[model samples]
Target: MARKTFNAQAHSLCLLVLVIVDAAAARGDVVSANASGEAMAQREFDYFALALQWPGSYCQRTRHCCSSSACCQSNPLAEFTIHGLWPDYNDGHYPSCCRDSDFSIKKISSLMPELQKHWPSLSCGSPSLCHGGKGIRQIFLYLNRNLLRSQFPDEKKHGTCSYPVILDEYSYFSVALDLYFKYNITKILSNEGILASNAETYSVEDIISAIKKAVGALPLLECRRGNGLNGDASSAISWLIVNEPFAPFNVL
Candidate 1:
């Protein structure tokens, strides 16, 4: 009888220990699951935060950012009101180049010809349009003329150069940012008494020297690819000229 009681006690203790261990394991599993769920929730919240910070200027006048055909042109107007150079959506339309909710890539590409048509007088020295200089000169003329003097204060300072700033093209499509810097530099030299009004006395080398001096003084020179972002020409130039670590592939 005593032996049987001892064996029964031992069996009961073993069962109790087993039950405790099983319960502990279950608790541990629940804790791990909860932690995973919390982490997922946190990640979702972070995504929402990023989404909230997205630029809201994607809409237009007759509609939201990408609403109308007129507002969403391939090469939209240069005017401040139509172009929307600033952060605020005032006087701006969304470009087809940007990621649009409504506009398609095919549609935007189709508009390039239309863009060339709308502004026929403004040329970038393209053979199809205004017939004039070639290569860099053509590029320079397009950028200088398309940029409105009032919008770009630096440009106003440059006055005008001996070289014809405006070239003949279909319509000025996209002005490069470098052109703005060059224009501003020219203006500063003119103001500083470096440039004489007499074109015969001044040569291209003199103009190049003035530009180099101005660039040396101005720490930031703005350069852009195609039509630039939000008139932040300085940053655009940084990305273009200097090493953009984030975008190694985006050389242009």
Candidate 2:
């Protein structure tokens, strides 16, 4: 899955969060058809902020070679694809936007099966057309959440400096491993709803709503608990991260 960035041509906020910032200006690249148009959505900003802060571990930060040795360089698609698969993987590294670090794998792992159960085809569709490939759901969720937000900021207002919670707590490796295994768990738990050998049954909105509901149900202690069966709050963060993990473009 290719991590998506905000397209100022199509959206409002100019920030590009989680995915690689380098791709924001690159041309001739094959982005999702909906990406350009959707990049302007409202959720883009939230997703973008979270995504931009991803630690070097999952983002392959060292790979980014820039003319100036200032900011970390990266590929949006690579980052998005990798992060979207599992959102709760926070490693104690303050993503650039903020200065903090902590890896919370157990917190993120608990939500994987529910995600898979809700949207089976999430990472299984065509990479270009929003189909399979492992990280597609992660990328798409980020894009979907922020795309519309970016385009219509006036319509839907989100706080500019909302503190990033989940990514700040887990590790990518732990999260991914959980997702891989939990997918099977979802099938076992929601067997009637989940047909064998079929893709996830829920729509993107359904998955998103479930995530929100799950997170809203968490108590302060529960939220802090994080990792390993932490329940809805963990799941909510996972869902948000999966949908929008990139920051708004920071170009002129």
Candidate 3:
């Protein structure tokens, strides 16, 4: 299956909570994408796979490198930035924004506090887009128009279709955040003495072992090709899938 990062062009919060961040089984570059076309939208989807992205990889690719992300800029110990929680099909292809709901500032006003705290936009821009008067959502939209091109697309595209069973927009995002908190990759790695360093690349087995040791299962570690700045051909996890051993997390 393809593990996508909740990419951020500039302002929108990039949150890719693709799958489980728990007892995971590490899948390497050999991941099969041979899922049939019918699998793309044949059913309502099995469950969500909340994937996360490495801030360094995300920033470098988007030209917004480290300095912009709070985790990258200040806290060397911060965890991975959220990519998104997608509605996955039984196969590789997943469902996308299927509803007619347009992006409205009012829709997510209630989630602002948590959104701002955990899912803050990593792109650099003036914070005064809100003008004055309870216009935080307005500012958010401004960023969506100018800076955040991908966030809303990912949300509406996937979020719209993830209703009824997943509840609504609020459940979609809140669950992803909850999953993120449940699986702390950085802390998991550190516990096993596997510190993250751009200079060193850990093997898939090693990464999997560390995660399993911490959480008692395997996790999917998705990576991106190197961008020549590092000279290394493969970068560490740009995307991750934490697995659940007991049973797949399906409210269905």
Candidate 4:
């Protein structure tokens, strides 16, 4: 397959990567065959696309800022956050809203802290109501309620399609969290002296090489034109196809 490359224009930063995983292996089950000797393991999707987003770039492009939004918080995030985990096909097509599963905050209560820190919602909510002078307890309640509502769409859309491999909403989110931490892109870039800066500019090859060295694969870069403070740009690593030995698919 021909690998795709996105040129880093004005101010590009690595946003996300679509990592591929074997469905059967992910479920920890051996493939079965029917009476006619046909493989019974029919995969609903080809791979998982783990999309991440840079808070700086997202906030910059967002014109309306709400107090409840992560970008408008007292201490805005300085790191990339989880955007979504989508089930995609190799042919550039995908499925959504596969099943009717209601998202529950209580199921992932333990992960709230990490989710809030790493997967916060960028979209605006009822700022006045979210930040209303209601007591600390009331504010917490409101935020939790909002979180459930915000996360439901994703669970219903993408998470549901993940099916047997991911199981439920908790698993869907937890798996993404695990992958995000396992491949710490920010740390990887910093190690190569590719720190986010307004005055400094980096070569696209250097950025790709740095990530390839760290992750054992080439990453796709994407740049956007916006009213960024210093021509801030973003890059996205297309797809990482994973097999038994966990080798990265050659994108060259």
Best by lDDT: 4
Instruction: Write down the TM-score of every candidate.
Output: 0.20, 0.18, 0.60, 0.72
State each model's CA lDDT, in order.
Answer: 0.21, 0.23, 0.47, 0.56
Give the TM-score (vs. native) of candidate 4. 0.72
lDDT of 2 by residue, 1-252 (tens): 422221111111111122112122212212121322232211111122222111222222234433321123332321111122211112321111111123233453554454322222212112232222122234333322322112111101111112232222223323333433432222332333422111232322343333234332111100111122112222112222222223112221
Error of 3 at 176 (Å): 1.0
* Candidate 1 vs 4: which has more TM-score: 4
lDDT of 1 by residue, 146-221 (tens): 3321122211111111011111121112221212323343255465454322122222234334534554321212
Ranking by lDDT: 4, 3, 2, 1
For candidate 2, the 10 contiguous residues with the lowest summed lDDT are 7-16
TM-score of 2: 0.18
lDDT, candidate 3, equals: 0.47
**Which candidate number would show the highest TM-score if scored against the true structure?**
4
- Residue-wise lDDT of candidate 3 within 42-62, one digit each (tens)? 245555666665555445445
Candidate 4 local lDDT, 1-252, one digit each (tens): 324333322233346664646436344222323334343443467667676766676666557865446766777566767777777666777655444434455766777788777777776643222112222223234444544223334534455567767776677768878878876777877899877665566665676777777887665455554453344334444433446322345322
Q: Which whole-number lDDT from 0 to 100 does residue 213 have in model 1?
A: 56
